[model samples]
Target: MNKIKIIAKKNQKEIRIDKFIKDNIRQNISRNQIQKLTISGKILVNQHIVKKNYKIKPLDFVEIEISNIPTIRDHLEYNNIIAEKINLDIIHEDEDIIVVNKPAGMVVHPGFGNYQGTLIHGIKYHFQNSNMKNFHLYRSGLVHRLDKDTSGLLVLAKNEYSKQCLSQQFYYRTIQREYRALIWGNILKEKGIITGFIGRDPKNRKRMTIFRNDEYHKGKYSITYYKVLERFQYLTYISCNIKTGKTHQIRTHFKYLGHPLFNDSIYGGNQIFMRKKYSNKNIEFLKTFLKILPRQALHAISISFIHPKNKKCYFHSPIPEDFQMVLQKCRKIFLQ
Candidate 1:
């Protein structure tokens, strides 16, 4: 069992009890868990048990007791094993906006099978010590998200006004997003557009697919325009621009074109080629070394969007190291 304590700051005044715990606590605990703990007299605010949605005031004390202990070591070990480092690179920043270079293999939010050490965790850690408000429930000032395996630029809003202003740009499809990906298979065309309605695959729940005729799927329109920047014997370096954002839009559209990302496990290409390349001699070593590069080669290279405060067009972020590594390897093996 472990005990946790928190002291609310001046800006954190009037923050909901459940939200404060969720934002501050790094344990694998949920809102329901916090609510239950509060109801069961396990959580105290100002040395007294309060309601689940109790609004906290400045200098208020919060204490939480956990019967089943949750350790940060286990979560840290999981991140280390998966090669998800917690280093955030700030590309461009202002009082209203911040653009950060998100690393590969890091989930954007806390979800099922992933509850801690995500980008949300990093952002929370940043705000915990900073002079920022603690009442936001929607992504904590983040305007958009990059996929867990997709590394690159992301813009965050610092205040409520900025969040609304930037969110409108995304909703209006005025934000310009460009991605660079190392996809499997040879491409026939130099440039083309893939337009389709994307939805979750009926057969495979883990993947999103081009829904042909499913009513329940509620397909959303997506468009991806790709131009080949470089070509290898069996791979292509493509620059992709999306007209509409959907879940796994680039990956699904490329897979539909028979060019899945290299090493993508869900949409086709896996390490089967590597397994065939290295047959017997200590397979454990191969797995250990190769697992360091487990994620697909996808990157959000640049994002150009209107600034929330001034409406000025700004671009930020760069191609991450992992994507560059894949390109370098492809050139060495296939082009050379």
Candidate 2:
């Protein structure tokens, strides 16, 4: 059996026992399974079995035991993940790793409806050119992932050892990621943290939603830290640091706080939601900015991780042009 241990940290209070375990573990164990494990004494709080409804307190120690968890490669079909020649914005590359700046609209790897022309396909082409033969397509060295429409830095490993080392870092939450986002409205707090569980919206299959504190059984625990960089008349430019990388984490967190990301159609930022009354010119000007930024106004700006060579490395990517244009227009119109 594989053992998973967690130390409840700040902002993780009053979370149900089963919900806490589900949020922290990567394995697909349902709450019912967790309840079974608790009854079987496989899940424990402070070395003692507790009821599933028991709330986790700060600094509480939780341990879970379960069978080996299957990795992505184990269940995915890699036979169709073929190589394709495409341009990649490589920020850094070494024998052990390849760090690439993934552009917005590019899927990181092969998946349903996106098997070709992915970053993995391009990486395979790159590996072939570099004579790194016999690399597994599934093990194409992706340490982490970004959304298809989210531009950011991603590091891929060249060998199993490198993959293991990097993947462990992510598993231990040692990797650091930072993002720049333009969210709707002028938030009052200069800096704040949003904490919640994130899971797929029952109403919309394509989107994710932030579960309330009481709805712990619904989603994975997610935390987002944001600091306002610039406050515009109708929007706010902010820097985000995510403690937990859940699907649509930053977007959902901001939306939960009533400030959806600018132009994030799925999260309700595509249309105006702040105030009903604005001058026609202001509304049209906002529409012009939205046209400038066709996607959610978010960018992965920086990342830091431990290299396989036992050295620390940091990488940064400038906000892409479309996002930059929106910022410039906002500054010109709102600040001036």
Candidate 3:
């Protein structure tokens, strides 16, 4: 059992007591558990038991007694390595939506190999004591996702209504998704669009390809508009905009264009050089000086869409750190 004491600061005034406890507590407790504690009089605001709906005021002292705290683990580490909490940069947030800068090498959702400690898990830990409910399954308020290796702006729906609205916009191809990437080899064209039907490569089941003839797979229509932002000796910095969101659309299209991402392994680029130069001997060594950039060199730099409630245009997210590092390396190697 552990106890936490919270003193509301001036900026935290008018914040809900439950929210305060949720944000401050280090223990791995669920929102449902926090609400249950509040109902059972296990939590006190200013020395008086209050309902879950009570909003905290400035200088209010909140105390919470947590019992039977469970040990949190991150299964993604594979060798019992715990997934550490990463500081996510929030570009924008409101009652309806949240936009965050997702870092590279972080999986967005839990999957077969990643059973615990993902982006969703962190959001759940952050909102564990709020009035918000039914979000446990969704893990935070995520409406859309960015691939684990691909870092960029991602949006989360604050409520079910917003989720449905935002999802519809994506389905209707109304949302504007943009990406910035460092592709291998110099691109001759300054601007162009790539359009084709994309599906899984028959020979390589792990990757997507622009299939010319395949009746069974039923490839989806995909399009991407790209403009060369800058050029290096053998690499090009390009800005990409996608009208349709297919699985690995930007990466696949770039692969078809004969200029795969700089360090992409699945689509084949210069991963061997990166791995060899960065050290790929053991896990510890890889995690150290090498930097675990296991995913492709692409990022969703920004996303713009209309607000469901007000129909106002909104944009969010920023260039991830890993991408920035890659850019810096390019500047040092080619520009110098």
Candidate 4:
């Protein structure tokens, strides 16, 4: 149980325990929440259990304990999305949020072609099994999204208030997010920032493009800061920090710098870039290894943001297995 402590001051007036708590707590704790805490004996006054109507005096100490509520099992509302049971790698879970380590190739949410087998679907199924309340309220608690091919930490809200709080952080760009990717070609600079206007491709509707000065007004301006972590003969592992979340900000910006992410087909990464001709044996080996990781080699390695209910707490996600696996194989080959 989480605990919160409040002390009455010399100028404090005789008020109800619930009102004192509602006014003193940092979070927007409601009167109903305090009453529920009282029923569960979670509210204490001077180390003794107290009712909601208990009057507070100067120097009175109030302590509150919060625990997950036990609710009856309810079926998940499967609205055009199937909540099928699947193996989910849940990283962390609290009363207000859930952090998931999403694997590669799993769509973050359902789309036209994918009605099942999404991260949202699997997580919702797990919640249904646990019989947790407020977890099914959202579009399955998903507040943000990742590309189907990109893998790593993703956070989901458990209730309406938490959702709003998390969404606001992302909207204001206060959240810290960093991604690691294997890009084709060696970077000339150790670190640099790429600024460009990003928008849907004028030539192809399926892709995003970088706009020039004349076309800046037509596209949304975006910024990406990148630094080389490890370099290889034909590829480099880089970390990217995105300032503006356009459709394909990271991939498009890297391509604009002439280095698309390895194996990303949509942005001209599939072709053999950079190095000149190679031996047939080397070509065959590279092709086989690339085929093993058919999707783009990008992972959301780090994410941090304030907790919805707790002002001092922050959330984080570590690198997943797929990203490590691909990195290992590339390092083994390229470093040799």
All candidates: TM-score = 0.67, 0.78, 0.64, 0.71
Model 1 has an lDDT value of: 0.71
**Which stretches in model 4 have alpha-carbon errors above 4 Å?**
1-80, 133-136, 275-281, 311-322
- Which consecutive 10 residues in model 2 have the weakest lDDT in total? 67-76
Off by over 4 Å in 1: 1-86, 133-137, 213-217, 271-292
Residue 221 lDDT, candidate 2, scale 0-100: 71
Candidate with maximal lDDT: 2
Report lDDT per candidate.
0.71, 0.81, 0.68, 0.75
lDDT at residue 236 of model 2 (Cα atoms): 95
Better of 1 and 4 by lDDT: 4
Lowest-lDDT window of 10 residues in candidate 1?
75-84
Error of 2 at 191 (Å): 0.2
- Model 4 gets an lDDT of 0.75
Better of 3 and 4 by lDDT: 4
Residue 194 of candidate 1: its Cα lDDT? Answer: 97
- Per-residue CA lDDT of model 2 for 204-226, tens digit only, reads 98999977768755566777888
Better of 3 and 4 by TM-score: 4
lDDT of 3 by residue, 71-162 (tens): 23322222232334556567776778877788877788667798766776556544443455334334444556677778878888877567
Report the C-alpha displacement of residue 332, candidate 4, in angstroms: 3.2
* Cα error, candidate 3, residue 176 (Å): 1.2
